[model samples]
Target: MMCFRQVTLSLILLLLGQATPSRLQSLGATKLRLVGPGSRPEEGRLEVLHNGQWGTVCDDNFALQEATVACRQLGFESALTWAHSAKYGQGEGPIWLDNVRCVGTESSLDQCSSNGWGISDCSHSEDIGVVCHPQRQRGYVSERVSNALGPQGRRLEEVRLKPILASAKRRNPVTEGAVEVKYEGQWRQVCDQGWTMNNSRVVCGMLGFPSQQPINSHYYRKVWNLKMKDPKSRLNSLTKKNSFWVHRVTCLGTEPHMASCQVQVSPARGKLRPACPGGMHAVVSCVPGPRFRPQKAKPPRRKDSWAQQEPKVRLRSGAQVGEGRIEVLMHHQWGTVCDHRWDLISASVVCRQLGFGSAREALFGAQLGQGLGPIHLSEVRCRGYERTLSDCRALEGSQNGCQHENDAAVRCNVPSMGFQNQVRLAGGRRPEEGVVEVQVEVNGIRRWGAVCSDHWGLTEAMVACRQLGLGFASHAIKDTWYWQGTPGAGEVVLSGVRCSGTELALQQCQRHGPVHCSHGAGRFSAGVSCTDSAPDLVMNAQLVQETAYLEDRPLSQLYCAHEENCLSKSADLMDWPYGYRRLLRFSSQIYNLGRADFRPKTGRHSWIWHQCHMHYHSIEVFTHYDLLTVNGSKVAEGHKASFCLEDTNCPTGLQRRYACANFGEQGVTVGCWDTYRHDIDCQWVDITDVGPGDYIFQVVVNPKFEVAESDFSNNMMQCRCKYDGHRVWLHNCHTGDSYRANAELSLEQEQRLRNNLI
Candidate 1:
């Protein structure tokens, strides 16, 4: 049916004269599509589709505001600049529209009042071009971020709160801190020049805090014996200088970030003084909502029990929750914990204190990343029963000479969603593969039951799969009559479970109200076929570091690449050697680290044939490669259109089975690697105008989350890089699994990885 649908759609498109090789090709057939040249998706010549033919927009009265609307239509944040005089070469065919006017905020160009359609006095040489800014521009952050570095690496509108002596640290993030703003890549103090709780609310929301509560700074100082610096004090006794960056911030208490709030910003340095004539910097304190606060242990049968404060601990530099360098609060300020004598017991204590179950792994020697500030405790010992790390013993001189490199780390055992025995798979071949079932607790008695077969689909099955830690959802079984009378089976508990499939837990699924089963478990129970073959795709760090290089390829030889839109905007000019594109090239080896093979979702009969690559595209997009700034904004990205999957190498116990060439099965067998050579087509992010600086090389596999896997946590790989125009240095390349193990592994373990790689 799918094949027939695809063929019929192709015929319809051909009849309409709207065939395209790109995804969503027929979408908005009479609308706009950005064409011509560009290294990334955000930059291109403006083209419009009128009637049946695609045409170009004339550069008549076109401005940056119009470019902004066009870029937004192409799904970009905003426009950086627009080109005139056919900078990306002239377009052929009819001039769709001329005298186009836009107010910059229009949803689409057509909505912005143009000179009708197909009306223009100019030729193709008047075609307009545009370059867009990447979505989510924070500022240029770097690896060498320090308090003494001044205002160089800070973002213009980034705001943060720092704590003095008595305050919440990284572990207890929501409790309290002094507000600070980042300007020109440096952290600076915000002057208390008309600051209010409305501004505090906005800052707290940005920090993941829910609400604002009035805090008595004097009471806190007295309780913790905190001695704050006097407002009139000088940085040094020699000179009296006030540290301030933002002044007179005005917020209505509803903005998400400080950037959204109205504020008078200042570049206060040298002779330029701060705006606060009252000699005070803005300060703020927040009370964490119930969700951010750890659960308290209530005394049994005690009417006069007092509530105890939750332990203070936090993870730093973690991409996701429950992992990172562990920090503990001592006295008032938060500091890193020493890795000396660090074990799972001490890690478990830290995890439990932060409202997590147990420690999955105790990472030593700063596995997440190096942290700033002091190393407070060392040689910490815990028996796994302590409620907090404060109950553990520490070395006498723990903080004497510890460095950030020795900072302790941990990966907490966060349950897949909140399904802690609430749901299970019954009557399956393996533990990870099974039919779905739900457990309900009523009157202190637990009852095991099955889900009703009515309206049960793959979307609901996804939540079940994730809850079971069995990877992505593969198939949803509507009926379970074939597997009836099996072990762990029970009466039907839930009926008509409707899920959007994005939910983390099964209980979160919307139901058809109080589920009433019309039949027994064996007759109407909904079954699921979960796969244990969840593939863990990890990038080869060694290949990226050793094989990375820059190349200047001619437009002629890159014809196949151009079809995939791999070249920059200048390529459209038909200029030969002078138009050669400079590309940062690197080989990427993707390894299947799971117990089962990684297979393509589409069947061979329906595979897309790419004329450029002369191969059947088994998968639309297998992975995403991006060059991002330190603050997680993408600078350049690889347009990997399609992939021909195959096993280039395999582990000792695995065998080669899949290949890209010919009509063979396409997949990466367990313990095997799929190598895309350094010079492979579309394996580079065009860095035309990117300045030399620190960057993060991030690659995410199955970004669409289409395929099933055993685990999705290890699908992303990241590396810190420093590019200096002529050279690129890739460092700290690792996956989440390696992060759980430790940043630096033993020689024996490294050898084992090499042996397992194909």
Candidate 2:
């Protein structure tokens, strides 16, 4: 409890001092501080002190990494967002840092690679600011409550959901309620003035349900109007003793407790602060996943099948636990939400529905990068209390004017974890290109040293770059002798730094401690060149939709498909070479619309060769196809197993570089697409034994995370499938990305597409 100041812990980490890094000793006295508005504590325009005068840092290329370093230097835990174009107003001093770059792990900004101090092409209009928080120190904990308020103090103490109309027995824990807060020993109903579902979400989270259920706001206002005006009414009687608790309540939806929110306390009972204004008491309902539905306790019955239905919404392609593009399940397919009017309230509704506290930031312009798929929700209007995004008011169709660049993303406040990585990149041409360095304890003292490069691979370098907050590793360098670093860093500290490529940090990678290095010189230290973008693969939905047809193939002719397990379980049970299976065949063209090429994870030497297929399978388990009931239970699977990647076609000016010929490298280049003919062996979903019914057909490319990509939200394509006894009707086939915003769908075309798998 005595560790009251978070800055004290930050100082401890700094004192553990690795080898003298960069020119920190010369500019070591350089200071950093946040200055500007007094209202927002620990948040303001970022200025650095150099040559004894404070000056603003240029926003030329300022990003999350720079903001992170600034926040950590100022003693805050982490950064929420970085502001450019002088968000807090321009300063009146020399610009100190220009084109400044940081990996965010550095104790001092001087360690970062930059264009140079005072050497800037920017002016005052390019100044940057940042917003940081103080309560997210992952490892440290305060035994006593931290009520020590700095410039900003706690907002509220006791807040509870006050159940209305519900019986007292079921209301003890209070799952559904009109919001109330306790102030100075008096409990009062919170005013609905400027009330949003986000406020309801905060109240629901406090009551143990992070996912706030949808409440009929109109019905509640009607009920309050009907009862509150009566002199003898119970609600009207309570007003004699207490008035509205707060004039206005503001929450970002990321707050763990209501006290963390900005609450405008009610003034003494007066006409100045009107009673609830045009609004009534704020009511909220909540449900805890599938386990605790806020309803009256009832005996179990077979009719409770609603509890087993698939969730209509999901988060995808998020690097962390609770952040990603919001996708809604619509008409048997997953699609993205358009960023039209996408803001905190809508983002908060999504976060709450996903069981996260609140949205820390509602990112726009595809900050997480564009995803592939249909943009389902456009101009989504959420008051924050919706059970899901689907419950909010939104445009009906996917044919919105929005593009993938306008895809919306939400960063939710996730629980802070305790794991820390001492890995960082140093001695490179730029911040994103560097030799890897790690702080390891040697003889009870933690010191910086290079990782031994003996047998070091790209997987190890990837963990290093990611630990530094850089993007995917583009190239893993086995030798770092050309790069310069601290003299002590020449000694290799970590040897055999092998990783399975799934680790987020070098600390989680497998390593040896006895210091075994085949190459004595740390020159062979592990290093990496990082890039912000990677290839993403999405299939041509129109081709799949129009080319689909069914065929009955005898078991004898499917020897290759059977070898790959492309047939269904029913095929395995059937008599060998005697029975026939119904196959749903379609032409699939996978295009690479990303910045990089989609290469096979394995090289030519490691590719698995099957006897039935003449070519090598570069990637194992590349794609998946499934036929599911409307409820999402799979009835049949596809012949999709592995992939032999190669550019089958290219843009007019581009040439194919990768081919799957005899012993060749394989990949699908950017701006190119590889197509598989409908008649290709095993390129269909097996539906021989499936009964005639409505079903959902889905396919996912690179179903496993064996390779890194800039975005994976668009890797899956789905379609609505209907079957009568003799034919299969495929419709609404779409990839879940905004690439089709320009393509208008004709109802007749989709409605007329009918065939059987051949």
Candidate 3:
């Protein structure tokens, strides 16, 4: 049936001769294929389908963003880096895409902002090739993230919250809002007709909620109607059009997804936007389980807020109720706990203390997303039965070299729902890596086949690897033509698989109700290369804090910095030889705390040489130093430019293997650090532009994520800044995963809120 459908669509498209690849996919045509050199499966000169003919993409303005779109369009995790000037080889066709600009998360090349199809100002010599990693290679598997892959069916593939009266985090199940369904790439409102509390229960469960509550729909209606009146709606610059879909859903309240429930759709659904009565949208309010209640001072044995003897703890950024990044309270501020010495036993204590049952998975390395503020506790050793983390043996400060990216998180619950069995890998020599195969129902016949490669991103591969018991996905492979997989697994059976990267299995990932692989299964079948471990890069927050100071740099000595755009925008107007630039100088020491080494994505053979710096730079833009206002806007930025990685310091037992002096192999070895001292050129943020009262001076490592690491949360370091014209004071320098104390005013507001919350 699928083949016949494809053939019929092909004939129709042949007759039209103007259909787009995305349009053809929507019509269920044969999957789009990027024809290129076949020697390297991970990278090739890219071609695109345009106006019924295949063509190449010009390298004009092609960079990481464009490369990412090309790689993702081919269904890989992300682009490591893109090659210009025909690195893979020139092609023999018209350039289809040029001046292609993308933010890197578009669903397809068609969706990204670009020049019109087949419109380019270049020839074949300017063709671009993209290198994609199917599963990400930059991340390491620090801890096993095991979550119950709950009951899932095609019926409830995705259910999202649409806020009316209040705002809620889009994917956080702990919040509440109206319910909507995703269909054919558009999020459509579910008709309120025949909707019941039982239906709400099913929607909530699909969103990882435990139960439902009464919604103030009338208030929501009032706020929703008043939305256009006031453009400043708190719900993320509100203004959403309504398109009602699928009326009359009946649930038994026990069905895991809405699949088992009876659904009644009108035959005239195609006519008049017509099906729902009164055009009312379905709304839901759910009770966040005990584990998900916003953090407070509540302890296991305390009824009083003032009795805070054990301190307080809470979770953040969890997909499900009992799962999240762990945060503890100390010294009247929120902070994170280090993952060193953390395990299931440690997670269980946090769970039980928070009134959650027990721990099912002890996640690590900011899997749920890193926290904010200080890392108050390190080397936490918890017994299975500890009443509180304080009752367990633990360190009180950040002396163990643990960074915020290594912050420990947890998923506390009962046994998993057996999602691991629903997904498998084949064609790889080892069990950990392969072309991914997942079980799904086609025409009511259950079978396993390769997934369509469309929007299969880092989060999607993470879920697949987790389900397969692979520690982490180092690459999301789209070129499966090279793999020798199981005989029957080449058939494409799934499409539009979108995951939050926090799902336990492929079953929990949302997909099209009908199979819709844009590039049908075979050659572009979804694949992943898994790893039990990968390198972890952490910026030395302590070093940044200790080395913080101010400098007055003369413009005469900043010709190279000016060439690199390392100085502020005001520098372009500055008087050349007479002016001085105020710089916030700080040393950066990045440590590799993971089991593997951190290497540049591109090899030294391909490194770019800069005449100004007189050195071969490994990464294009490795780090970003920004001076942000209290509300988070860049007031100034660093004079930093292209960087080279090498070990500058290590413990007694570890030997240094990399140096930039002679263009030697460069990498930050495990248990070692690579330092760019404060006195080095381009190591300072040029802050001469403004009179700043308070600001956030932040440094982020691997900001573009061209390479893999264990945790990204700690890659960013932020410090509170106070400046009076002559000098600047830097304090509370915390990693992204650590919580910096709020400004004094916000701190006071926090105390009142905490008191009221308690």
Tell me each candidate's TM-score. Answer: 0.39, 0.42, 0.49
Q: Roughly what TM-score does model 3 have, to 2 decimal places?
A: 0.49
Q: Which segments of candidate 2 are over 4 A away from where they belong? A: 1-323, 352-357, 365-369, 399-405, 412-421, 440-463, 478-486, 489-504, 508-524, 540-587, 593-672, 676-707, 711-758
Task: Give candidate 3 regions above 4 Å deviation.
Answer: 1-387, 391-414, 452-456, 478-481, 484-500, 506-525, 569-580, 639-642, 740-758
> Model 3, range 1-758, lDDT digits (tens) per residue?
00000011122222223211211112112123333443333466666656545577888877898777666555455788887898766666577888888787766777766787777789888888777763421233332221111112122235666655444542343346767766545566677777798888656655544456677777766765575356665322322323554566766564334533555432222343443635456788754444344445233232322123343787764534466678886765678898755655567567656545446556666676655457989778653445577778889747877676677888764222346677889888788888899887667888888888787766677678877877667777778788776887778877888886556678777888877766776788888887766666778787888888889988899998788788888889988978899988989888886657888877878888888888877887788999898788888887354466888998787799888887688888877889999988889898887795988888888786566555566678777788898888886666665433222334334335446546
What is the Cα-based TM-score of model 1?
0.39
Error of 2 at 61 (Å): 41
Clashes of each: 14, 19, 20
**Candidate 3: what lDDT?**
0.65
* Candidate lDDT (C-alpha), each: 0.61, 0.66, 0.65
Ranking by lDDT: 2, 3, 1
lDDT of 1 by residue, 203-265 (tens): 664454434556675554453222234443332221134446555677656333354345554
> Top model by lDDT, which number?
2
Give the range of the ten consecutive residues with the poorest summed lDDT in model 3.
1-10
For model 1, what is the error of residue 704's alpha carbon versus the real structure, in angstroms, after optimal superposition?
A: 1.6
